[model samples]
Target: MTRAPAPGHGGMASTRTHSAEKKRNSVTKAPTRLWGGRFEGGPSDALARLSVSVQFDWRLAPYDLMGSRAHARVLNRAGLLTDDELERMIGALDDLEAACRSGEFRPAVADEDVHTALERGLLERLGALGGKLRAGRSRNDQVATDLRLYLRDHARQIVSRLVELETALIAQAEHNLGVAAPGMTHLQHAQPVLFSHQLLAHVQPLTRDIDRLRDWDKRAAISPLGSGALAGSSLPLDPQATAAELGFDAAAPNSMDAVADRDFVAEFLFAAALIGVHLSRLGEEVCLWASQEFRWIEMDDTYATGSSIMPQKKNPDVAELARGKAGRLIGHLVGLLTTLKGLPLTYNRDLQEDKEGAFDAVETLLLVLPAMSGLIATMRVNTERLETSAPDGFALATDLAELLVRRGVAFRDAHEVVGHLVVWCQVNDKDFDDLTDDELAKVSPHLTPDVREVLNVQGALASRKAYGGTAPDRVREQIAALRAQVNDHASWAADSEA
Candidate 1:
């Protein structure tokens, strides 16, 4: 049996040696680093191999291909590449992309990074003409440019998935309409609320996460391609031309800031962390709602797992995993922040550390967001259990006071009367509804047959007909408004593309 090759070194040729071989065979017989003129000799084989990023960055093929085309046109416009050379490079880039997409482009293990692999591919495809495309650009600028494009694309996909998750939550809320549940504060039941209201609370934060991604794209719109190698290029290049071709609103103003800025990366992490927080909030509720004591929700067998030791146990593995993954999302943010913090201006080896953090965050959220949506969509709400738990906390005791006010009892006095009656029921092992008229009258001779009016939980919930209340009428109105907001958010995302 053949042994697998070790990481960092595949067989005898180091990652750097492979890079040099690629450069050696490349259109430039000199095998030049885009910025190697300042150096006396090529990087050490071990150092080159150690610094390689082609493995993960191959994911940037599309962005690299697109950006190369954009840069080629920009160079042609600047009178540097000539129109014929530009056409050749563009055609070669397209063919190279097709090769990558079709799995025919064999990546070199020593190919320093994605920028290097891309240049190597272009050279192999276009012969000597590919050399002209890199006349003024460095991998420093190229990598940064590719990353921005990749993130912009990834953010759109994740936010769309997030919107889908929000839609599922909204649908669940609608399906469980009028299902009464106890709303809690400090883990103790505080009031009666529609179960939909609680689910909608989780939806609102995730929706904000989608909005955050859409907003951050605006900041990422500037292209960094022309900020070659930290200092502005001396080639008299037109940054705006490339920026326009690439769909950037403008060229980044400062060269050093352009290569050094992983702020866009950090912003994506910021957005991902917020999504993590929202998922954690939803996960916590899922865990609680699925508990034996609560028993307000049931996880589908497909989404849940049975305990190994306990034969009858059905656990919410999906929510538990989501809650667990939320920690990883936070760790990605902190790791990226710490990695980028205190780094010097312009490009550094440390910026290479940026990819894993963001890539992990995006990968985790992409999986968890969609899985959570499916879990919520398929799970059943135990409406009877929700209603049964609703009346335990004397959730309608406040309604009794509201009833007194309608009867012309001063609110302050009515509040005292309800408080006394609640204590009376508690001391006697009775629910607020279990108290008889004689018992209610003992607390208040003013309490009439109308005291029976406050005993019904449905009547109590219905009386709360104020705007945004959990009353059936109010909930329906809220549903309409929430649906409208979802449509408005969708429209805003569409307008951004316009």
Candidate 2:
């Protein structure tokens, strides 16, 4: 029964502390390497167990392999590697990467992160030749480079999915252009609006989200591979050549800045959080519109579910999941921000906590955006329900004031008169159009029965003839603009990877 050390035991302790422990789980190594040369003994097994990130960071192997291959090519061309040695090193790296991707390679428990795991794999695969690949880099720069590569690729994917979601939104809007619904303020009817106009409002913000992700990609394009530790490597390596080969737009100019700038990570998650808010807003509407009380839209069977106990229940599980997903996306952003708030220096083990958050945000957006898009595209808008509800409340009251303003009445006097009329209608258990002509004229003798002409929901929506209004023409104009924006994005998305 050997007891655990108090707080700071400093020997090469046993590795049995971790429950799922395996021999290959820690960053196993040659003890006398450059990083460990100053130390007499190794990290205690307890420390190793706590410090290892191989369990999750092994996801980075492919990126690690790519950076290592690029570095090896640069070193050999700079006359560092012998011709035969370079060939053996490059061949082994390529093979190791292929094995990792093909699932034949397994990272051992002794490996700490993907960088260490890959190096271990390389050393075993090519013996002495593999040792030469680490000549001009550190895990600091290497891990940062790998993360940048991973982010660029993932951001591009998220942007494309956002575009797809925008397209679905536009499709739904166009399909329901003539549809009218009660636009609400604080969840109560405020005005009659084209259903398509409501849909367009949702589309534009998500479109901005796509642009935000694209903007993030441009910033994330700098390469971090030459910034070894917190200083530039002394090796006469061409950072540009490696950047170009690896598809980075430029080499990171400063070593410390390269490793310290986790801003991109936080930026991405923040953008994801904004997009998640958009999805949540969209989901809230879907959940509401699909409700038996509103019935503005019906969820198609594929995107809805049933209640086991209630035989007639058709639950909107998809939208509910979108609502739930938004919380995760937002949590990811907050989690990463908290992780980065007070960190010091070029790299710390604290930085390793960064991966789980980013991985979750990316995965959530990729999944949530598409599912939400499909839900929108397949939904059925019950136009009659919307129209009936749109007119039931005095939703056209604003249209009445606009009509009065158009009729040579002072706008201030018209607002007063309109408010009185609404209160009258509400008290009498009637609607705006249900008012008698004499009642309106009592408030303002200049008013006539013709005022009721502006009181219907369609009249209310159609009367908003300003640019970007809920008028049918404005809705069509917006649909055209949305379509154009989506087409441009589609083309850019198609050519992005190329």
Candidate 3:
């Protein structure tokens, strides 16, 4: 229930009050406002309500404190603070962090944002010396620095989780090796493919997503700490030193761009949104495969829920949520892009809209990636159903065409022949298996009984022996490649954290 003291209170205590109660009251009195030099009055209640961001941005407190610590070192290097003052400042910040961790510190309603609250906490801890911490920094640059640091840490976390999810997929593919399934085009059964091939298809895009996070991290690694407001700092501050302290790769090249650039956030949102879309596609399959019509997979009890009204009804709530949340993730990306689009230059209060969406996305994927991985890891795959379904719906039609091509029939002629046969089968309520050699030969002289060799599921699978194809060996190669890629990222994420 403890709140940060109001602006300017900065925890300054008056020692001259005679009565103990009066002395306590005087100690807790609001101090002079940090930016009240020209203002005759404080912000209106509505303005305060509209402006305060600490409610959500408090998650950035640790990053803010980290930035402050880095800034403190830079300040000492600039001779803005003595070594003694720097020592006291670090100790006080450490105490403030402990208080924040223990729930002993929280933002006051009067505080505008986390920056304001932490400044107040620091002032309370070190009195006047705490005031020096704000000398060469503006909240604008400090917030930019904090957001980058926060996202860098979180991006690594996201990478690690992605690796877990990828590993789960690799395991699933390895477990279900050579199990055949119907692959689709436009949601209609188009071909017979190994279940492992389908699983590795999903793995390919996720690998690119991890690559995107790694690429974004490189750009986001630059420090914006010494970029005062929208211009470079007047003081002789060493941005490289600050960057090194905060684990950034370098200082930002342009101070204005440094303060105003939210491309990093937009890129992160885009990455998260794409991740959502990928997971939704995976979720849709789970929902489909778990249904009575498909019955290709049995939902694990741990990852599925039963309906309240129906005794026999098990609902795919987890998959459904993952599918639904994709829209939310897209909305977050669009909303943030819109916020950034119209801003003219430099820092704007509108930038306050940035943190919540980014934070929600990070937290959301943290849950979703693990849940999806667990769902895949534990679910029972009905390989019999998958194999049985693989050759149905004339799924081997393409293989029939290819077999004709091998028989020296022109591809166009083969395609038309197969197309006609497909319509004929549909109208006659018969499948390729029911076709007579005479009937097939009537359509094309080249359609001999030997063509029947390629009309079944195994032949359909074996014909695709090219690299990246659905043949068992190719799929095994894909899984191995995917595992190596996942392992590389896993190593990078672990090393980066170290």
The prediction achieving the highest lDDT against the true structure is: 3
- Model 3 stretches astray by more than 4 angstroms: 1-28, 31-33
Question: How many collisions between residues are there in candidate 1?
Answer: 1
lDDT of 3 by residue, 298-349 (tens): 9889999998889999888888999999998999999999999999889998
**lDDT of each prediction vs. the true structure?**
0.79, 0.79, 0.85
Using TM-score as the measure, which candidate wins? 3
Compute the lDDT for candidate 3: 0.85
Per-residue error at 171 for model 3, in Å?
A: 0.9
Summing lDDT over every window of 10 consecutive residues in candidate 3, give the lowest-scoring window: 1-10
Off by over 4 Å in 1: 1-33, 404-415, 445-448, 488-498
Report clash pairs, candidate 1.
Answer: 15-110
Report the alpha-carbon TM-score of model 1 versus the true structure.
Answer: 0.88
lDDT assessment of candidate 2? 0.79
